[model samples]
Target: MFKVIAVAGSPRREGNSATLLKAALAGATAAGAQAEVVYLNDLSFRGCQGCQPCTADDTCRVQDELTPVLGRLRQADVWLLGAPIYFDGVSGQMKLFFDRLHHLTNEAGQLRKMLPGRRAAAIVVTYEDKPRDDYREVAQRLANYLGWMGRFDPVEVVSLGRLGPSDAAAARPELLAEARALGQRLVEQLAQQGRTDG
Candidate 1:
């Protein structure tokens, strides 16, 4: 049982979002939890083509980096989705990931029976300062969608706005602590429910 699985939605390898996510993973590890990171940039995921073919088997047959990712998401305890806001939404790279999840299910708009009981967390970073509600709005909607599919709602959502890649290091003291606390909270919650993975 893995403690946590973090998926990076940023296109940049060491971007602000990815850096913060790594800090979160470290915090989870400090709490005696295991963590793994997957970067979307390294994957060969094809954006949703709207073929509507996965409904037959309830799985995407195009077969790429996302195949194993979906399989891994099933067994993961805590999921960390870190993405930078692009035009008030997540970048296209991560947007494709979300789209693929939709395509992974059936025509009835119902998630496959394989998805349920999974715990997740959302970390949204943006260059837009002044604390915009876009990230929270989108993240909450995403969480609601996941909850409808029977996946556990995220224990907390972190919004770090108006940050730059250079500032990520300096923001470590504050954001890093938030990310760490997020990790410990998720681990404790999952453990209390007998989920040893977190």
Candidate 2:
């Protein structure tokens, strides 16, 4: 069975980002994929130390709660990342996590481990009524980074805006449905690729 990991970067467990992530995981599970969710706020971890140890060994030197998460990400067939927009970008939790992903590449800027044909989806939530392109750009940049570092192709970005309240997303059934459908579609696409390869 395909393995999928959903990382929630919001401090609020039931916040918009986390809710969407849970919905996505539910859809992935229903689609016959092994799905797991990681709440970054629940874990105690530090940002990248700039030690550059990964440049030599292709592995992060600072080991913490995020160590296991990095391992799981390496093994998963699909990655679903969800975070709220903060100051025109992803939350601090998500940014720290992204920094830790420096281990994915080497000094030469080459991927330390190639995960070809993998898939990824980024869910970005914003409170601003007029969701600026900056938010979408940030999400798209994340998708592009994953594509370059992990060989994840066709990364999808689901941007939700005007969610001022924590429960705002819950009120929008359409948004949740969209997230679920994206999850299912990703798994189905991977399954199809596996069949075609076999």
What TM-score fits each model? Answer: 0.85, 0.91
Q: Give stretches of model 1 more than 4 Å off.
A: 103-113, 196-198
For candidate 1, list the clashing residue pairs, or say none: 3-197
Clashing pairs in 2: none
What C-alpha lDDT do the candidate models reach, one value each?
Answer: 0.71, 0.80
- Model number with the top lDDT: 2
**Looking at candidate 1, what is the lDDT of residue 53?**
68
Cα lDDT tens digits, model 1, 1-198, are 445888888877677788778878887887778898999988998987777767666676667878898788767778788888887788888889878776444545655543555565655555556677776787667666555444564556677766866456346687778777777777766667664232
TM-score of 1: 0.85
Q: For candidate 2, what is the lDDT?
A: 0.80
In candidate 2, stretches whose alpha carbon ends up further than 4 angstroms from where it belongs are: 107-113, 195-198
Per-residue lDDT tens digits for candidate 2, residues 1-198, read 888899999998898988888888888888999999999999999999988768766688988999999999888877899898988789999999999988776655555544445555555555545767778888888887786566564478877778879998888899889888878888888877672242
Candidate No. with top TM-score: 2
Q: What is the number of backbone collisions in each predicted candidate, taken in the order shown?
A: 1, 0
